[model samples]
Target: MPGPVMPDQAIGTSMRNKDRISAFLTLLPSIILIGIFVYGFIGNTFWISLSDWGGAAALAENPVKSYVGFANYLDLFTGFLGGGFRQDLVNAVFYSVMLLAGAIGIGLILAMLLDNKPRGESFFRTVFLYPMSLSFIVTGTIWRWMLAPQGGVNILPTYVGLPPLRFPWLSSTDAILLFNWQNLLPIALYLVSLVLIIWGLWRLKNNPAKALVLLIPGVVVGGSVWLWGDLLPQALFMEEIHGFNTATFGIIMATIWQYSGYTMALYLAGFTGISQDLRDAAMLDGASTAKYYRYIALPMVKPITISAIIILSHISLKMFDLIFAMTGPDNGQTGHPALNMYLTTFRANDFARGAAIAIILFIIAATFIIPYMISSYRQRRSR
Candidate 1:
């Protein structure tokens, strides 16, 4: 027993449908362009990575591409010729860790100092942030000169009546914390277990039961790995060692100098957004300035810290131009995946392997970004 629809209701419904159709039409072109360009290219690259499209005929007009499944990936990780790539991967990990620690730590300190409204704050902020305005190439070049073996930094010691140090900043052959590639499987398992245990400990206060679920499995796996690690199959047939090269210290220092300012700005803005009444309340409760920031202000700006970590992680992964300008591609001590990819593709004409490296980098980048995206989406939906 439905009532007859009103003429006004019908008109409004028709108008709403029309509006929906108009919006869809307006967005259709962008959707099409992105599909054919960004996603399409990514799909094509992935296909190339799985194909045998390399060698001398790779660049030919009618070049052949045959499916080879995951062979390229397998070869990169375990092949005899992939030692350089493995070392480069290790270098990238070290670079990411150092950059995250140095930039976030220094930036937070600077932000806290400025939050006190010190004299000449504006000038100091400008001075600290000036390096960020320069391109990576410029920063790399400047740092290269500063870190020279017998010049810039080395000469500073002579002015104070000390002998000029002759340490090779970019050409050093020394490496530390060496680990055999043959132990890769056990090492990887240990890392996973460590992560789980740390994560569980971090969440123990809020959700003890769930934390126990994580901790139990983590401890069991770690103990098992420690006891039976030798039983695990070796990642390679022969031993190959990799470690952190001392040569990359200069590059790391330069990167920290450039990006710390950017992070400082992010943290400063987050600090500025905190309500003054909250500060007064904290003071009334007898909270010292250090305790107020540590216990209250930092927790409020957790999102800012996450954002900085994500941004810096991405930059660290794609550290091509800076590394090239500072140490060049030939400097194996300071190599990165992006530079290695470029050299493999254009210089060595290995298209398939290059695509494989690209896809690996893309996957690594996604690991940092996808989690943040999912968290942000959840936050938005909850709101």
Candidate 2:
């Protein structure tokens, strides 16, 4: 600390400081642009969601906007006229679950098969991935015809002397797993308890103390819900039933067919990066091919799986083009929140409600993305 700085050292420090200043100046424009455009638009959208901005006045040059707090959001959730939105929300949940399961499962299987290096591996890989090259609109149009009630899939049985299936693929009225919106509080609590209990059970062997902490609260909440759930106030004065509609089956099938190949490519890349020597060592240790993949390869590619889930979850949330091409926007049987938002804003001239719907979707997307980002940051810092 007492030594005087040498000429070369002092020059080096000065150069470093100058370089830092140059870098910051270069990045300043982009930072300002993003702040004004992206975050600014988001903030403006949120403000619109909290105001009254709809009807014929919405398109006016200086539309009168009055703050309405969370009225728009409340109306979407519990208002009598929100029945369609409620059903669409339920459909979105089912769509997300089925898409994640089907795409990830089929992709994993396809990747595993290709990893064996069969003859014509390149050709098979290309064939499997070809569907992903087409746009959603194209895929939806193709599947729409193939799923027609009397023409395509339904007529396959006729080739073997069986009568054509009479089941309607896109216009079915059947529904299952019905639940009342009136009992929303209890159902939500039950779901929370289930998630906690499942998570605790999964971690029980690894960290008993932490697991017990999660388990005990989960049990208490579940027991309270079971014992006194009826005391909770109903979300709606009238019964509003929602469930998985049978009509969405065809749309889901087409989505899986289109996206499974994309996920398969993701998994294949992850599998390819693994060291061959490591795989050989596992085989030498008496691990079967299935065990090698299930226990070794999968764990190594956890990042890839997480990435796929995040991407698919976002895609499922904003699915519009495919649903539109398969069943038009007016088709109540295959309605989605994105389509509903469009109709409410443009067709019905309800700008505030549309903004509310957009905010809700944004929040839901953040829920999936924020946790992943935080975890990734923590992991990098730890490393």
Candidate 3:
């Protein structure tokens, strides 16, 4: 009574307890999300992937219960996922690789241009980023209109007198590259790598001068693309550019265009965070543009590069909506990676195989996403 109940100092323990409870409350929603959305889905899918049932056919009180065990997995790994079991998995992998390469390569360049603040930087940035806000369906729809056989986009070539404008890019393989960009990705990276490796090897070899010519990294990368361009079918040459069935090509082009802007945004943000002083210092030391980007900018934004690659890979892995919207699920068994899964699951209502295919996609996404998450954790810790 003498000290008036010593208001504050009465109990530090109570305040500490209150603080702990508040911290737990603050994290409650996140914890719930991790449990339900993340862990729960993972567990549910994992169990589903192990079964022979899928879609509406998945639930039934049967005698033997099939006990398919890992048969579904074998079928998935082999070719049974699509019944005839073609190389659907391989095709998906290929498409994913293409998407990743296209997004990063074109995105980085576009991002750099946008960064330059050239005329209409805001407009261009929006044009590039707007797709990111829209659903893949929207992206597919818009591109489809542009690439349709008798669309306004095709008319431009005709109007300009280029004249090779009648192909439905998504249907024909002729405009081969008009939209076959999906395939060009791996090829592009291959070309770039080949040139670099060739030049670097040449440099490492006997003649230093020849090596110098061969070893210039840029030259090597440029040559690879030139060589690849030389290898496609002659009609793919432009005269044939407009006539061929380029459905596959169109898909490629669609993917490249839609995803590139997103990658560009990622790189742009990463670029801004880099210290301008370091870049200027490199310039002061007389570093060439190429060298400066290669050494200074590249290293500083390595995380962004990794982030872009990981993101694109995941996007490619789960790439269902775009493919479906553009070409529907018809050729999915062959060229449409997500096609086989969607058609089998929804239209044909083949749940078992469809879920299996989705599981396969999940595996792919996990491969890239998990590592990136781990890297992010490490990054946070370092900070």
lDDT against the true structure, each candidate: 0.95, 0.94, 0.67
RMSD list, candidates in order = 1.6, 1.5, 10.1
Clashes per candidate (backbone, < 3 Å): 0, 0, 19
lDDT of each residue in 1-383, candidate 2, tens digit only: 58999999999999999999999999999999999998898899899999999988889999999999999999989999999998998899999999999999999999999999999999989998999999989999999999998799999999999999998999998999999999999999999999999999999999999999999999999999999999999999999999999999999999999889899999999999999999999999999999999999999999999999999999999789999999999988788899999999999989999999989988999999999999999999999
TM-score of 2: 0.96
Query: By summed lDDT, which 10 consecutive residues of candidate 1 come out lowest?
Result: 148-157
In terms of lDDT, model 1 sits at 0.95
Q: For residues 296-346, write the lDDT of model 3, one tens digit per residue.
A: 776788888888888777777666687778777675333544667677676
User: How does residue 371 of candidate 2 score in lDDT?
Assistant: 95
Model 3 lDDT, residue 251, Cα: 62
Error of 1 at 369 (Å): 0.6
Best model number under lDDT? 1
